[model samples]
Target: MGEPSHEATTAPQEDLSSEATTTARGNHAEELTGAAAMFANDRASQHLGITVDDHGPGWAQCSMTITDIMANGHEITHGGYIFLFADTTFAMACNYPGSTTVASGGDIDFLKPTYVGDTLVARGKEIVKQGRSGIYDIEVTRGEEIVAVYRGRSRTLPARKPTTSDAAAPPVPTSP
Candidate 1:
């Protein structure tokens, strides 16, 4: 992987399909969410509009838009979509492989007003984790300027239940 372009108003890093992406970010393809990850999407995005970008921890990034469902009375953007960007990326970073995480709480600062046709991106990095709780430093960046920074927490699950795959791998045939 080479280095990802550090730019403002950037498009989705092309088709990021290469296992060895041309980005400084190390490959975490194994952690990529398929249909298995919880919260695959919310009813708001219309279509599934969330994805992980080529980034490393304690750093992560995601992109979402100001859809009709996400616009406010003024036909501008809303806070929920902003939270969506933040929370989604945070989930990817915390729920990684080892941690089964849920959002404990968060604080978001809205720096500037957003409008329709704006493509917003959110980024999060795990700053610290201990026991069953961790703090994530988050940034909601539009273009190059950061519109918001969220401090979020992931509360660990006591004992997570088996996923479909975990339970569907048929038991080994018993030999008499």
Candidate 2:
């Protein structure tokens, strides 16, 4: 309808070769315990309005409502939003009760169109976990119908410095 509700945005991948060596090895014993805590700094997920419905060892469920801002040129939900929803669930499933994990690569198939105001739920499950790598499958559904499927490959990052809730500390002072 109106110039494709929300245009998708992507960021360049970060190079952490140096920071990885130091932080990954130092904080092994202190990773966050829950999805909310572990992803408190996930601005991308937060900005997209995705919410965790449930999560536990090797499994996660998340949901998002397709707003006008999330529709594409055809007035249906954008494929990127669906992928983001699935990816978020995959991350939660892979990292529960473990160190940080990131998607190494992923693929998706769109099965049906989703419309504005539709509430889409994404469910993720670990298909396999070996050594430092894992495979996850995610299904995106609306009510009783399937909308998309996503498969992701994940690799656990070496534990990094512990993260704390920003609310737990005083705001850093800024120079006037």
Candidate 3:
């Protein structure tokens, strides 16, 4: 009928959903773990008692227990502490072993108050990545209740010139 439609003549289309699935599976486990560990030792995070609980290619989780030092005059955890926890998670999620990522900008919304001895957990996930720019969202929670939310914009730096020491080191295995 009318010389077979062009749409019918085209080859079967590839599944678009598979592209997202494939990207999700691109996580390098070893690199993710190594990066999380390195971030755990950051001076500010360390000083604030932040610990990285998990991370992947575009996701991360970190936690901090509110101590006396983190409390404000009102006896509630300072907003800055909550923001730091979320920021650290965002940083860890955006960075990998060979590439450096920095925050171009970010903002936070404080939803609830956190008190001393409360353990706050911040989970960060990548919203999108196009070319060199990316967006991340972080949720800060105390137990089952959300305390704050943060949005961060990131830019990945160009590949660095490898030094002799770096060039000599073996690539970290993606699998355990």
Candidate 4:
């Protein structure tokens, strides 16, 4: 197979650009709603240069280019980075506007070694969601080649009543 290009191979540039625009605009208007809003404050994913390409009610797609910093002693991309990518995608899929969902557990199977400069796209889809629990499947790909598959279990946290301290504290201001 040919080497994967640095450009996204799954979604077209126009589509990805449009989605990015929508996310940016949404951030300005809502600032604290939906998966896009949740991702806005995600320092870890942002630090790793992971971008959320698309997301909706039950699915999300994100991409990250493997950098030299991500490489292990043997020079291949480390497994933790791949897992983090997939886990972030899974988080985007299961979270909604009003709820906070966290990964209960996840497991990944690496199918191939990933090298520095390789751009990997992780697509996550909700397999099932019942009550407060959900199952998601994420596939990590380089071009059309599958590199890893991750299965994630999620649990939506129960809404907690405001404590006396919370009631006494002033509301934190959100960024515009």
Which candidate achieves the best TM-score against the true structure?
4
What tens digits encode model 2's per-residue C-alpha lDDT throughout 1-176?
01211111121122323342233333332323435335444568867778766677677878888889989999998899899889988887887564668899999999999999999988888999998899999999999999999999999888655468534645543347
Clashing pairs in 2: 24-159
lDDT of each: 0.61, 0.72, 0.71, 0.78
Error of 4 at 61 (Å): 0.4
Cα TM-score per model:
0.66, 0.72, 0.71, 0.77
> Stretches of candidate 4 above 4 Å error?
1-30, 169-176
- What local lDDT score does residue 117 receive in model 2, on the 0 to 100 scale? 90
lDDT of 1: 0.61
Q: Model 2, stretches more than 4 Å misplaced?
A: 1-31, 161-176
Identify the superior model by lDDT, candidate 1 or candidate 4: 4
Score candidate 4 by lDDT. Answer: 0.78
Off by over 4 Å in 3: 1-34, 37-41, 162-176
Put down candidate 1 lDDT per residue, 76-155, tens digits, no spaces. Answer: 77877787678777765566433457889988888887877778887778889898889998788779988878889888
lDDT of prediction 2: 0.72
The true-structure Cα RMSD of candidate 2 reads 11.9
List the candidate numbers ranked by lDDT, top first.
4, 2, 3, 1
Worst 10 residues of 3 by lDDT: 1-10
Give me the displacement of residue 31 in model 2, in angstroms: 8.2
Query: What's the residue-level lDDT of 136 in candidate 4?
Result: 95
Query: Which residue window of length 10 is worst by lDDT in model 1?
Result: 20-29
